[model samples]
Target: MSTDTDRPLWLSGHMAPVPDEIDAVGLEVTGTLPDELTGRYFRNGPNPLPGNDSGHWFTGHGMIHGVRLNGGRAEWYRNRWVRTKKLADNSPFLRDDLTFDRAAVHANTHVIPHAGKILALVEVGFPYEMTPELETVGPCDFGGRLTTGMTAHPKQDPVTGELLFFGYGFMGPYLTYHRLSADGELVESRDIDVPGPTMMHDFAITENHVVWMDLPVVFDLELVNGSMPFRWDDGYGARLGVMPRHGDGPVRWFDIDPCYVFHVGNAHEDEQGRVVLDGARYSPAAFTAIWSETGGPVSEVPAADAKDPATAAASTGSARLHRWTLDPATGKATEEALDDRGVEFPTHDDTRTGHRHRYLYTEADGGAIVKYDLRTGSSTALELGADMAPGEAVFVPAEGARAEDEGWLMTIVSDRAGKGSELLVVNAADLSRTASVRLPRRVPAGFHGSWIPDA
Candidate 1:
């Protein structure tokens, strides 16, 4: 058994891993559930085994928590660990030749439904397919056409239905972009040029282009045996790349200030032909502090002062909503901070993805779900109190909806005391509570998830 002092911060409190999996039926529901929500809410996260710790919070085995709803009823709930070779047979990720066995990864970052299949995804490996019942169907490589690892945050065009994503590696071909047909076929792949390998977490999309984030946090050979093999390098400058989706033109790169963005809210081409990208941005001080506390290498820059209460609060590496406008004509970029609050997991309506969006939704570190009106420059939030921790809020459009905000936001809220968990449904227009289904167990604070409506 591990004591509190010996355990890392990721293994304790709200981020603690659950030991086993179970199922329950006929969960309790508070308030009225929308009848149109007749599908499954699947969330993927890192959950190590009972006696195992994967060194870093991001390296645990993937576990999915699923909830089924139908006809205003909470039908059932179940949790399952994604059965990968790494989890079952202790397969090595890095082979003897220094190449990676893509199947031997955690697959713990995101769970998304694309084409007709549900995939459990991690940035470093091939995606593992999962059944609607949460059973692993093994790894998928798009008929072996995907030579590189798949990104967990693939963007499916709301208009063309083609899925666009990219993969980055610590090798010569550091980055590669891929596209999937509407029928899920690997149609195109292109090698992108970059200076060095960096930890590129997420990107954005426009109607006719794909956005890329080339940040400064990079892999270190000296730290390969440590908890995380990456560290912040000030030498590698940051930039955003815009590549034409269907054209063979080279990527248009726009230099920007040094910052790290883990999640992008949305991106679109403006009337002035500038690509406007919105995301959660973290400063150097903020990233260094949070990275050190989360089992990562400490950077040369000093972390925020923990002795000062105000500075300590900012040390959580809380990312604020920021926007960047890149002009293709002038080859320049402009940035602005949209809000001052600390938030993460920025989400927008799927229908408006890669297009001009009026609203963006995010969860605050203070246990609140915030809704931002980008058009009016205002925001509203539904506070869940200090004892509740909510995961990413996924937007589900209403049936025959006309307005973009006419939808519901679904999230799994966990009790800070580890008492229990619940699936919360809130009206997107007003941030009002529509319903909440009490879960049978405490679902740990997770990464990303999706809502799959019935066909």
Candidate 2:
């Protein structure tokens, strides 16, 4: 119910949206930019317009902040608002029948370059097309072949070069799977069977199968007050589904104890044909606490006991890297905790998207970047010192990379003292800072981004 003037820290201060778009040329650089890094790094997130109210951090109008790099130089920087129909009309997206108007996309979650086009994506609406220069080009429905929304976390198969994605809605046929050809055409679309409308944010693609997370978060139309309509539904249950990548069969769902997964690191099929899925896991209690902090009202649930250890831990949305192993032959799935730290935004080498990866990158709750070695179970962290916070770290492979993790990890860092923002590039192998490009102003910490190479 609070306005932008008095919104939570996530929606105000340096995290707040800039009133107007700006462009600057020849950004200053503190160190030599990698010669191999010749592309634009763009990150998208909610940046509600002035005096506008979305009531939730996740639902604000989409804005993109980007930096262009070329020939070992920080070329330029720009920011632009994604001009969507709902945003232009200054109206809410939900209609009387609960169906979204086709162009209601906020386009704020993730930005990626695919099939010679840069796509800004939100889960509930069509992907918004943006130029390499950061100007909105309107909604892209793949030549009218795509009828459903597109997930921001689409996976491009490293081997097949096909883009694999899904969409989830509050209405029937709640989930759907889609595949795009390497040349960027909508090739396959199928309705995925699920029990109900649950919040399916992200999924995983193994070499041979597609992994689905049907968690407890469900939509509540009556709870809408200009914020996210989803709340924790304990009765909805939790499960994981595995389906063949190219086959037509029922998605085999395996029941799991109630838990929520937002982002998946990577997945693959083991030698035994068991699907291995890994990501950050949040307990039900933790989920409630985090959602509550978004400054949005949630449906009432019984309070937890103060003296209980598990209950206290759930009061904070502290997620730990967790692993799930699904044995197809036995139709069973088992999960275990990989680490006990509070982490989010887990990522790995994109080239290994559908294959087993050894290293995982995550943003620690304490404002540090951590790399976890899955094979040795060892961990390392890179601290940006005090008064500095970094957003998601995306891995960019070196030119003709030798190993999976031998490239560079890049992220936009915000200086807490209002000093300004800079792009920090770290060596993925040893977690060393390699380059820092100083921008004209502080770029707020936001959601997912990708490194699109010029070559």
Candidate 3:
């Protein structure tokens, strides 16, 4: 636990399995996002220092970043480079068994201890380094062959409590700011506002709009917008906006429906600021959209994956999850109440700030944590099933926890058969059973996780 100079600049993310080791296997994760942006876009972090027995993690991709070393029980996993993403066409390729090795997925950046410090915000790309000549003019317009890229998001900075990241490296459009001191072993720093490189994902920053949920023909956002030449088609329709991070004036749009892979949790406003989109997911619910300022509401939640055609043709994909009640100002809609109750939806959810709504699901067989009592429509299950796999759960209510503690959930318990991935915990109301470790294998489903209560 000594990377020397004292340790505790952690940022952790995971997804494991199939390790004869090195070149990646089945679902991967490694870290680095002080703009060394690594790959595989989902799950990886580090700065976890205490016992530091090589828990080393930090991740980012599409503008590279690294650092992966999760050795425990048996051992055999390591990779280093304090930092790299100096964009020389941002390279990191060599696929042996090949399992997504670049794109630096996300999740884990919502901590802000305060005074003594503990900020570790994340979202990446843009460590831009030599690789210009397809028509230079790069620094982070999202161009430079993407070499010097950034465009990442995951916010939280209500002021000095630090830990607010928004990326686009190679020195453009940054907003990074980390602070963690109090002798846990780490100093401090800054970065703010930002201008160039823009593709900010699923955002929500209000004191004056940064509100994001974008998609306007991404061939990687029009190949970094040099002259707006087009050809990209990572198509997902897209539109749900708000601007003025420093202004270009009126860049507001909300045509709704086209949110390919969306998730906007914990947005607040009421007492007149208006907005309230307690939860979201555009597909899997045929329809979804909501906003506020005296408007926005769309409802529909009463799932159906199929009645019985042998798991409905293997669940064709309705997956299942419904509980609608969009009140976008009198558009008035309601799905009554679990209609007939019988679910298998919500791949992720963890919210709090009122009307009581706590959902985190995954099923065909297991993983759950549901508690929604939005005024007695009632819905409570608080935990369930074999080595639960509550997809994306995290609800940290009450500051510093423990009141019989109604806050705890950090998941991943799927086994691709030995060393696939297994990191579980559940007790956020009824979902009993705390700590359940089983990562001697299987982890290629690392979508998100966080629970560093002053560590």
Candidate 4:
């Protein structure tokens, strides 16, 4: 057995991988689970097999933990590994001829319900289809209409129910935007022009446009053998692009300060016709520190310049909520920091995904679920205490809700000692615990998830 000191940070403590799949029923609940909150919560993340390490936290095989709730009770909880080609026989993602086998990737980043199917997603591979029970049905290519890898962070338009997403590769034609109709038909695909290939993890969409983050992290061939081949390249520069949602007009690119954004909160068009975007922004030094700890390549930037005091002091990575306002009239972009607290996994009401919104929800690095009210320029947080670490706070709107934040925030809070886990349901309006279902085992900290309601 490997000693704790010998293991990578991703393989130790709360980030540790579970041994195998298991299930439990009639879980213990601390408080009443709202009757209207009936749904299945599924979360996806990297979980390397026992005695196996994928070299990096982001490259491990995909595993999903699911919980079922109905009639104000926790019904069942189970976990399963996504049966990808890479997971079945350890197939190589890159073939001998230097081409990618899209199915041979760890679809471990995010899980969302699109159309009539639940998809497990990763940026560099085809999405794996999962049944309502969390069984793998195989990879999907949208009836063979999707030719490139699908992003894990697709945005569903609340008004039209269309899914808008993009795919990026290290090769030419680096980025391509795609759209899926409300009924799940792959309707549109357009090639987006970008300078080069970068680790474009997430993007934003407004009422009439698509927002792209072309940051400085570029792919390097020399780092191909490493855990992640991308690194911070200050020379590449950082810019955000705004393109029409339905027109052939050229994208308006606005040069911005050097930074990185892994997740976007929301985007919308203001009354003055400006595109406003919100996300968790990471400084170069902060990104470098977190990247290095996650088994990524060390930045070429000097150690003196790459050491961030604020980031070094936090257990989770440091990223502050920020906003950018792009004016089409003057072709200029203005940036501002919304908060100084280190936070990630920003979420908002889906009804306001591509429209003006009043509230934003996020998980603070210091173990709290924070709510930001943009209208009042104030924020509130529900502290999870020292032993508990909260995952992404996914917002679920209450039925017939009039207020923007009249809903519940569902998240998985894992114990730092790796003892156990629980599904925490918090009232979005008051930030109070509505219920807590004790999980059967300690769930390793993972990526994004979704609340799939029964139709």
Which one is best on lDDT?
Answer: 4
Candidate models: Cα lDDT each: 0.91, 0.85, 0.33, 0.92
Ranking by TM-score: 4, 1, 2, 3
Residue 285, model 4: lDDT of 75
**What would the per-residue lDDT of candidate 3 be over residues 1-455, giving only the tens digit for each residue?**
63323432221122221222232332232221111111111223322222322222232211111112222111122221112322233343323564222332221222222233322223443321111111112222222233322233344434333322344332333333332233322233234443333333445544444454544323233333231222212234444444444434544545443323334444433454434343334232222211111011222321331223353234222223333333335533333223233333232222232222334333333445555443355556654454444445544443444432355444555532223454444555565655544344434333343333322
* lDDT of candidate 4 over 1-455, digit per residue (tens): 76767889889878999999999999999999999878899999999999898788999899999999999999999999999999998888889999889999999999999888999999998999999888999999999998789999999999999999999998988999999999999999999999899999999999899999999889998989887999988779889999999978789999998889999999999999999999999887778778888888874542323465554445244889999999999999999999999999999999898999999999997789999999898999999987789999999999999999999999999988788899999999999999999999999999999999989
The TM-score of candidate 3 is 0.29
Deviation (Å) of 429 in candidate 1: 0.7
Model 1 clashing residue pairs (backbone): none
Model 3 ranges with Cα > 4 A deviation = 1-55, 59-122, 126-141, 145-165, 168-202, 205-208, 211-271, 275-367, 371-379, 393-412, 415-441, 448-455
Ranking by lDDT, best first? 4, 1, 2, 3
In the predicted model 2, the residue pairs found to clash are none
Candidate 2: regions farther than 4 A off? 1-6, 95-99, 299-309, 417-419
User: For model 2, what is the C-alpha lDDT against the true structure?
Assistant: 0.85
lDDT tens digits by residue: candidate 1, 277-367: 9999987767877787778988445332333457546556788899999999899999999999999999999988899999999999789
Clashes of each: 0, 0, 60, 0
